[model samples]
Structures are given as structure tokens and as C-alpha cells.
Target: MTAAIWTDGVPVQGLGLMRLTDDGWGDSDRDPATLVQVALDEGVTLLDTAEMYGNEDIVGRALGSHRDQITLCSKFGVYRGDSGRHDDWYVRADPATVRTAVDGSLGRLGVDHLDLYYLHHRSEETPIEETVEAMAELKQAGKIRALGLSNVTLEDIRRAHAVHPIAAVQEQWSLTQRGVEDYLPTLAELGIALVAHSPMGHGVLNQNADGELAHELSRIASELGVGAGQVALAWVHQCARQTQGTVIPLPGTSSVSHLRANVAASRIELGDVDIRRLTAAV
Candidate 1:
């Protein structure tokens, strides 16, 4: 089977659960069944999550070996409280912690193995080599199919890649958040895919980017006749494509309609003129 562009060796769509809070944006998100159906209908096969999201139960219920067909990605290294804020986060790359976390995730997700697993964030608490060692053990033992890392520097990525072949790197990269640009060349050189999580800048470029994002999104939105969100996403996709790795932008919403709009951005190819305008302004 062909692995997905973002998943390294796993096949799927990456559903970001960071903002799937109980906000009544629409009917689909409140109901897991509705969310799964909509995603399947739209051919969005990769679903993403994390232990911190507190919705793995819903995902485990929604997936149901249908997970075998869908590529589900997730991350660890961040701890969540009842309120879903990062309170007591641990960046330990210890083997025991990794084992315990993966077990908890598997139990909550109702699955044997995650298609792709990433270290949620990197810090000085644990060396990248240690983290990579623990991750390699997990992959060898079948806890996850592939390994990935998030919020890592290029040097950290290189060290981890030395220990194991990381499938993808998850980061906050959008037309609005272009921090990943500084390190993308290393990714291209290493053959790892980039999963740009918030291509819409946490809904800023589409909803409320302060100044520059606002101006650029408005112009692109008017030209595309789609929406600011769509335009911002398209710009990220174009950049990801240019870098030669796949762009998996996980823009989450409670509404099925909005999720469909996010999917549409993948198909909305911007012209050179449009790309030039958006790229230069940002």
C-alpha cells in the first residue's frame, strides 16, 4: 500500500483536534458519527489527535477498524488538564514514559497501533537522541507504524533522524505562520514530509489576521471568490508543494461545511500572479 505524503509510511488524512472543543460551531463536530461520515464522504482519510485532546474516545469509537483504511496521526509530549490547557507538560524522552503514554493512547483510541506518532514538542528536558530511541522501540514493537517529531529545530531533527527515520514533522506553518520556512530546506534534504498543522494561522488569515495577514487574505479571498480561510490555506499548500514535500493542513472546525471548505483549498490552485501577490505581501 502507498503511504500518504504526510504520514511517512502511513496512509490517511490528518484531523487536528486542538480546537474541536464543545463549541457549537455546527452539528457535525458535536456528534462523532456525523464527523466520521462527513470526512469519509469527502475522502479525508487521515485523522489526527493527541492525548491532550480528551476526544480519543470519540475517535476510537468513530474509527472502528475503518481506521485500517484511514490514516490517523497523533502526537505526545504535552499533558492536558480537565480544561485542556498545557499545565504539567513533560518533555521526557524516557522509554518508560513513552511506553505508558502509548498504552494510554491505544486504550483511549481503541486501536492497536497508531499509523503515525510524533513527539508533540521538543525542549531541553530530553535530548532528541533519547526521544528517537524510545520512538524506534515503539515502532519496532508495533505501537506505531512510523515516527515523527514536532516543534523541533533542524539540528534536533537531524539528530532524531540519525536515530530513526522520522516520517513527518508537525509544525505550526501557514501563510500566516511561516516560521517553518527557515528550516524547510533541511526537511527537503532529509526526505521527510512536512505536516503544516495550522495553515490558516489558527483561523487568523481567514478570520482575523491582525494587519498583514488581514490584507493579504482579503485580497486573495476576493480573487478566489472562496473565503479568506480558503485562500490562506491554498497559499500554504502551494509553498509546501514548492518545498517538494506534501502539505497536510489540518484546519479543524465543528461544522462539516467548513471542513469541506478546508478540503476544497487543496483543489483550488492559485495562479502565479495570485501566489506572487500573497507570497510577497506576507
Candidate 2:
């Protein structure tokens, strides 16, 4: 639907898109367009899409008139076929690949310049240094505004940041997944923002990590006066209050109402007890 999460570090806000694995929109009652509009009206400024999602067309269609008002992040690395082999993922980012990926993303997104581009690289085949250098050059050349990385280690981040100024780092950081915590302090020291994908724990955390985003929403519908996604988003906000608020959680849905509820979570304030329960439950 949209990533209503924003990092206080940069002025740009965010809207993280899902690969949309299924056909039905959330709640089985909404279409893509209505949900996109609601997010735009509510101050979500960054739209995240990936080459793997096969939803660039849908994302492009939903962007409509608000394209200029948002910051868009599209990722590329592992090349996929229609058959969905989806493997042999590139652990390294190459200049040629990054260039070609940006060109393709620009074509699919129908835009000239990308707001932020990440090296969807995730392996050891190619030297990450070579790839990050290319990313730096791309930013200097006006192909992208900012450079980011995903699924990387602390050492990888250190090496990459030494070569270029990274605007953000996208990772799987949620109440259930605290691995990033071990390294997030280093990121904070480096001034890099955390784009927490699956911040709702893929619909598991708010649903108590039950593996269904919809069911999770139902479980927390009454307590916080919002959906489960809202509760989870609120938890992230609290997590960052003690940190840098650099924790930008991405909770997406095809439902307009749920998307709004997700945004409303930005204003939610979970009590210290609730925060303790949510944090430890993970």
C-alpha cells in the first residue's frame, strides 16, 4: 500500500511497497489506486519498489499525479525470469549492472531521476567496493539523489560509507528481528538512517508473530484503538525515540483503510509497559 514511515534524519518521508505476492488487496475490498491516493494525501513521500516485485507497472499506475511530491527508491541486483527461479542472487554490485538497473527502473517508473538508489547486492562474487564507487559516480552524475544499501554487514557498511555518503540503509529491523540492533548503533554513529522493511514483521509481530498480516491486525484491533500494523509502527517509533528516530518502518498494504491506519500509527504512543511487552515478545 504505502510506507508511512519517515526518518527524522532526512527531510524526505517514505512509503514502502510490497511485492504483492497475492492478487487480493488487503481486506479484500480495495484496489491499488484508492490506497495509493490515501497514502499520498497523508504525507508519505518515499515510494519503495523493487525489480523482483513485478509490481512496477502497478506502482507506476498508482503514482498518478503525486510523483513529484515523493521520494522513490527502486532496487535491483538479482535478475529474475518469469519462471521465478529468483536465485543466484548477486552478492556484489557492479557498475554496469547498477547503470542498467537504473535505466530499466527509470523506464518502468517513467521518471528521469531516481530519488534514492540501493545496491540490491547481497553476495561475494563481485567486490562491493567497485559497485559502491559506481553508485557514488551515479549520484555525482545526477542519475540518483542518494545511495543506500541493503542486507549488508557492519564491515560492508563501513567500507561503503568510507567511499561515499550513504543517505540510508534498508534492512529487516523489527521487534521480532533484533539482529540489526547489534549493528544499528554503528549506523547511527555514521549518520545513516535505518529503513526497516517488514517493520510489522510481515504481519507477524502485531499479530504476535503469527505469520499472517491480516490476522495480526485482528488480534490488536482493540487495545491501541488501531490495527495491528499501527501497534507495530508505534513500537518502532518508540524504539527510535531512545535511538535516533532513524528507524523508518515500512508497513504496506493494498487496503486504503489499513494504509491510513498505518499512517495513524505514526501518532500512536504506546505506554512503557506496552513497549516492554512488544520488545521482549520479539
Compute the lDDT of residue 229 as modeled in candidate 2. Answer: 65
RMSD each, Å = 3.0, 4.6
TM-scores for every candidate against the unseen true structure? 0.88, 0.84
lDDT tens digits by residue: candidate 1, 10-105: 322356765554443355445665666678788777788887677777777766657766777777877644564557555655667788889889
* Candidate 1 global CA lDDT score: 0.75
Candidate closest to the true structure, highest TM-score: 1
Candidate 2 is scored at a TM of 0.84
Model 2 residue-pair collision total:
7
lDDT of 1 at 7: 41
What are the lDDT scores of the predictions, listed in order?
0.75, 0.71
Instruction: Please report how far candidate 2 places residue 151 from its true position, in Å.
Output: 0.6
Q: Candidate 1 — which residues are off by over 4 angstroms?
A: 1-13, 21-29, 80-90
lDDT of 1 at 84: 48
